[model samples]
Target: MDLHARLKTYLQNNPEAVGKVVDYNAGTDRLFPLDLTAANTELTTAIIADTQAFSNWVSDKLRANNCRYGIGGYMEHRTIYAVSSHFDTEDEPRRLHLGIDIWSDAGTPVYAPLAGKVHSFQDNNNQGDYGPAIILQHDLNGLALYSLYGHLSRQSLDGLSVGMSVHKNQQIATLGNNQENGQWPPHLHFQLMFDMEGNYGDYPGVCKYSEKEKYRKNIPDPGLLLGF
Candidate 1:
């Protein structure tokens, strides 16, 4: 079987082996499905330009809906990329998000969904970047897979080393604030990869719209493990 099919089958066969990435109670806490695309008429260019305003808008929406977390953005073509030139390229802009963003408080704890070892990690502190990112390597039976956690607190990298063993459901890091989290709203960018493409410490969480097919094979929907 191919990597994508193998991953889905593995997760489907061992649901209990996977753990939560963030704290959430289906019986109490609610989740707001956020939309950052142009279809979201409420998100204006002004709000997108101002980090604080953009954060406020997200919080306000969650509050209005009585939700504790705002979630979505797998393969979402967002217009919000206009806020940064970091996503721009010579031919096409990279507005296609390959990860699922979990919007919550800055200090929110993040946990590993499965047993893995730290493949690589670093603080990619470029503006509109991942800030602090970590990539973990795992083996599904004999198939190698990877998971990436981006926009994390810098403290998350403290004392961390390559090849460090991480237990399933272990607290790996916490969400970062705007000051250190690439100047965006506090959120965890979680993604799964079958291949890193020789990338270490960082990988492209957003790709050019035209390259969607190429990425689709390497990066699969995180919800497979997130269980959304």
Candidate 2:
């Protein structure tokens, strides 16, 4: 089987952690899918101007929707990337996002969806970085898969070691605010990776528009795991 099939098979085979992620239960939580692309000009214009505005916009959306979280942007070509030089390069410019972003208030607790040992973590402090992030390595039927939790509060990494074990639904971290979480609205950037490509502490959560096919295979739709 190809990597996508293998991942889907493994995840389906072990279906315990589907709703265990942050406030994304299909039945209970009022979750709304957010659009952050250029086509969402009203929202983009309101948020892209500044981080505070971004935070306010997120809060307003959540409140108006009566939702605990606004989640979307998997492989989404977002205009919000312009706020940071981290995505800007002389080359293709990383606009294609590769993960599902769960927009919520700062300090919202993030739970580990599956049991695994911490593979790696670091404070990727930059304009558009992960901030304090954690990655876990899970072996499901001998399939080595990884889950990355990004834009976490600094305290999340406290006493956290590379080899520490995290159980399913474990409270691993909380959402970081704008100042520390790469200057965007407070949210959790959750991603799945079949392979890390020899990178540590961080992986490409966003890629260039031209490399969609290559990444599409490597990064499956997170909705498969989030269960909503």
Candidate 3:
């Protein structure tokens, strides 16, 4: 099915799964505007200065509480230059982020948003990669779709099987830290995939700027399901 059709199908089938929200990159009110331009000036001083330490501190807090809080906003901009070089294909520049990153602490409890079976998972261990991950298949009102939870702790997949059953809000896994997870700050990379296209335990979370149209057609905005 087409991207829009797949989204409509998911919404129509799984009303309960919709409207659940998670924030991205939460922090105290003191860190408002996290303006990039202003931050550039201070970049020369230290690598682990304010911004780096701040992300680290936030990760620790979120992981300890097993919760996340940030502005649950959508990707308003189309041309994202982030993580482009990570891909092997020359089209990396066209790739866009197909997921909504819930920037929270490591070890936070990641619950199943809806009842589903464990479709697949993997430990995509690499820099800027999804560490241990889980993909759940939800069949709501006969509309089948998948949700991916990335950057999870290794223990999260301890007893998981391909067809393992997971109920809504069930504690499935905890957020992972950079040590075991992909070598990056702590965060949950949540994405929705309509067609697996024969890929398992790994999929394209990032795409190039030039391939936005094609990806947008294949991967709908995740906020449609996350409800933010």
Clashing pairs in 2: none
Error of 3 at 139 (Å): 1.6
Residue-wise lDDT of candidate 3 within 147-173, one digit each (tens)? Answer: 888888998879889999988768888
- Candidate 1: misplaced stretches above 4 Å? none
Q: How do the residues 54-173 of candidate 2 rate in per-residue lDDT, one tens digit apiece?
A: 788889988999998988988899877877788898977899999999999899999888888999999999888898899988877777888999999988889989889989888999
Per-residue alpha-carbon lDDT of candidate 1 for residues 5-118, written as tens digits (9 for 90 to 100): 998888889888799899878889899999989999989999989989988888898899999999999999999998899999998999999999999989899999999899
The full ranking of all candidates by TM-score, starting with the best, is 1, 2, 3
Error of 2 at 44 (Å): 4.3
Summed backbone clashes in each candidate are 0, 0, 15
Could you tell me the C-alpha RMSD of candidate 1 in Å? 0.8
TM-score of each: 0.98, 0.94, 0.73
Cα RMSDs of all predictions? Answer: 0.8, 1.5, 5.5
* lDDT: worst 10-residue window of model 3: 29-38
Candidate 2 vs 3: which has more TM-score = 2
